[model samples]
Target: MALLAAFVGTPVAAAADDPDLTSFYQQKLSWERCGQDLQSGARSDGAGQPPGFRKRLECARLEVPRDYGNPGRSTMQVQLIRLKATGPGKRLGSLVLNPGGPGASGVNYLIDSGNSFANLGRRYDIVSFDPRGTGHTEPVSCGSKLAPPPGSGADDSLAAKEKRINEACGRYSGGLLRWVGTQDVARDMDVLRAAVRDDKLNYLGFSYGTKLGAVYAHEFPRKVGRMVLDSVEDPTKNAWQTALSQVRGFQRALDDFAADCTRQADCPLGTDEGKAQDQLRHWYQQLSEQPMKVKGETVDETSYVYALREALYSRSDWPALRQALEQLRHGDGAGILRLSDAGGGSAAHSDSVPARRIGQDELPPQDQLALRAISCRDTSERYGADDYPRAERELTKASPLFGPDIAPTLLDCYNWPAAGDDASRDVAAPDAPPLLLVATTNDPATPYQGAFNMARELRNSSIVLTYRGEGHAAYTTGDPCVQRHVDDFLLSGTLPKSHTSCS
Candidate 1:
């Protein structure tokens, strides 16, 4: 499948006088043709065209050395998209963005919401690309195994279900998972940078994308021109720590949601905020024993309620949560399941949604072994057999909403073929460029503390702004303060003072 590419490109040549690309690549950088069918002046659809959005702009594949360490025999194509600046002369450079998820496609991101980048789209050429094994870039599928349990509730047969899914994932995703690590994505970014002939790369990443941005900074610090990492993830923390922190984040958000619900008369939980929480706890305890019967469907405690809570992580979906809760209070599980499936469904189910826009596929079936190998080789020593139960107990106390899934998801890494990376590496490199990190005080997905840690480690960097609101990322929600701060930094290279707050 050909990757969809977008964004504008300008002709930029390396300075012959400079020893390395430092002068031209980092300073006074310009865009170039990327040497693909997606030209500097126009757009083209390359491969893997989605059904309805078939006419969406296409991309050209620029084959790069699959492994940077061994550039000779290996090769992989990194997909790119470009949307030229709307305002002429106002254009300075290209602004690359990633919408978190690690699996989110940059190309489709520009397609669906490119305009949200007010003042930005006018001043800089906007471009996004699918990282390798993502989107149109030779995707990675864990086959049908990693798919969410069908319908609203999980399979009652836990052991058998887990064994089945794990075996399927292991079998279908042969070796691609190993190469889907951040390092590989970073290399793709470098290739995209060189392909466009940019002197320096300006980046805006959210959630998991922030981790990608951080890794890129560490790998190619000098190449970083202006970076805004919103809803940041800490590069220093191991996957387990990061996941555990999300448990707390999700709990806080749940509290906030429950409190808000009390203000609404429609809130079935109750008008008293504390009472509402108690009611929720009671509901979970009750459902754990006797699952609810919704439309003749057996709605289990773990799947249904947790799905509703997860939906609350993004304010944009709060209304749906309210509706789901109302439906559940009346004994209807179908609505909640549908909503959850829409929001959390795997690629196969949501294939109708533009592959590049809704989400990015983690790894192709071919790379699972590689993903396991690299992750285990990197982070194996950090976990033990006791980790799962410990995480479960700890998370249960953290938040009633996400406690169950948070720990289990993280613990999956403990049993993963590859444990994890040596998170001990010094994440903050002094040589790295000044970075703008954005954090939400109550982000359920990435968590705020992780953002703080990322900022601390990137000593040269500054907190462009922190959102006091709740959500995974404020940029997509059109937070004025976030939008402005990002615009200023990318357009003018100005960073807000330390610990800046966004209303």
Candidate 2:
């Protein structure tokens, strides 16, 4: 697959002349085979690498400055994993990937699903790295003690909790806290791109990753080779706007789920979609008052809502969600508890959804800390003392089941000490080659409209590939049409015709 023949190029001289980054770009990666059994560790010494070497996957660490602005100060290691191209044809450089969560382990994601990218791997070196402050990359640790207890509902008290967390992170992470934003990561990607000998970046990013890719393209348009942003996030939205949009998107997904459930004989939400939502609201209220006990653990309103949010990320998990709701109604809170655990990165499962336990899938406390730290510092939106009440009201109006829960979490940036840089920008990458934007109609995390908004922002330089379906991301969802379009785009610089829609 000679994807993007125009993208082919000999290694360009280091993209930057900054003395601080000269060594970084010149550094060579000593790749070593890594096995699947390796536990995901927070250190950069390949502690996450399996005990015995394996030929299929290779791991390496790249050193980058903790603060690019003050590169002389300190440095951190970014752990990366690669599955080299197994090609009979000419290799097409590296295809970097990120799996969304500001904290998700990209290397771990690639290791778990390397085969899924085999088609591309045969033509490109599939590379993924743990971004700064995540996954063995000098992880940011605020300590698990600072985290709110499970099922802790959104309330005024959360402000204090967030303040404490911010303080802890500041104390623990020191100067590294402010440098963990998406912009910093985008710059890091450029350094990595040069280190890997790719003259131009070939990248695929999903969810939060979309934001990263957009920032990268905005920052280094000329370096962008072939880029794909799936489940697109709108860069023009402020923090509050993004959160509110997600709250509404999730509600829409729930409504869709409810409507689907009504068509089933064993639907626990009942036949009327509106009534079904009301039932869910009532259940949440009841759980708020008294959490249901299951296997010595309790399922509270926050847990239930978060679990539903996670299950709604993909349609494949809908059956599990239904079973969970049914089990909850029957006085067995185990199902919901498992779902909540799964949402929190646990490997718990029910018959409906078979959960795969990746070593890095279960986020450690440090990764969670990194997620909050990066998110708070990357967005310009902050909740003020007076904003919460207004937000709560609007959220409840937008979504009865998810509004109240979703609204309070935004308070995370309220007391955060690290200031946010504006991550939302109008991306104009005219020098960059055309890119593909994948969006699902009812994507709960990054809503569908975001894709259109991003497409409009990119203008003629981008193509919108719409999947008229439900799910957070379009590709790798077992949708042949979506896969074919993506494969065609990534494998050959063939852009889908404008306004291409897939089912």
Candidate 3:
């Protein structure tokens, strides 16, 4: 509350006056040849790629407030990429995108999947930025290895580990920890909208990005143009509720996987649902007693659960998950370890893979730490170790396979340095134009209910496109039907009928 009080008393103009951000909003970017060190996806349109499109990507940096309230205190640069529209169609200004991950890098996303934006790219300049505390935009750093060695932390209490992380972030992170919340990022988005010269914000945000997009709508409702939120998160849910939702979501995906697995003759989980669940639970017990090693890294019960949770985000990974589980019975830990190290190496974002880096492996340590920094700062929930046991029992009962893995997330904000504000979660954009929300029924990261919840909060101004499918996102799944609706909306501002469902 003190944090909020300090910012609220800033007169808001103190920032613009102190830092004189009018200069920032008026400054123009100097584009240059992008470096391979930065680019993630293939550089150009591949064979059979989208037509009328070629990658003319360029990179630049935009200056923003390190502390938005007291902008004169400091400044930080936001890394951004632009995929100029290639089509002969009349330009529709700049179309900005955020690929969820409150911690995900939009710069990498645009460069990696430039071709995916061919349709919109031809009509609008597709732009993305690495939000603060992520990518090259002054990312959060924990100074040391985030987790204590596999078995070493076992002796420490849960709160001790939490304190260790809090101390490390407080020590490092370049003094940017307190300012990386979604509200700050949304403020950055407005500056981004201005820097790009877009009269209004046209955006595509997925997962946590949806939270970002919705907050932007609330903050700058009149400035919103066409917006699409996929794999949505219910901003109203605090950190603990969000964690609980993910637990249930992962468990639901597991049941879905189990049901799908039994139909296969070579199913490792067996034919009966009951037996399949029992088998999985039994493997958890087995892995707990005898951890596996792969490529010089330890794979304990915690890693095993994470690997499974990672696979549940997309059905495409289910085959790998099955293979991993099968190979586990045969004592090979390589497959599951790969999945564990997958998902952009971040902890929570259910994003399958970046646009350009197919079969990419090894998520950066910073991404994992950034997730904690941004999520903790936005979430006001300050769960203590005393609260862990009850949440654990409840989550475990909800999902014996995934609950333990998620229980620890509830405590992420315990000793966080910055105080979280309600503005990040309040998405009451009553005056904003209608927005499109694409949600998948079986999404494990941002459950479908979150999308529906978002629509409700938007005051019935959002159209919900339900894809009764699996995966964390809908449009990226290559479902022509889903893509058509999204393309039509982004390209021509068409909205599917309300309560529309696509299989």
Work out the TM-score per prediction: 0.77, 0.87, 0.88
Model 3 CA deviation exceeding 4 Å by range: 1-20, 40-55, 145-155, 345-364
Q: What would the per-residue lDDT of candidate 3 be over residues 27-125, giving only the tens digit for each residue?
A: 577777677667644333344545532346688899988886666778999998888877798989888888877677777666556666677778898
lDDT (0 to 1) per candidate: 0.60, 0.75, 0.77
So what's the TM-score on candidate 1?
A: 0.77
Best by TM-score: 3
lDDT of 1 at 448: 73
lDDT (Cα, 0-100) at 317 in candidate 1:
73
Between candidates 1 and 2, the one scoring higher on lDDT is: 2
Return the top candidate by lDDT: 3
Model 1: per-residue Cα lDDT at residue 466: 81
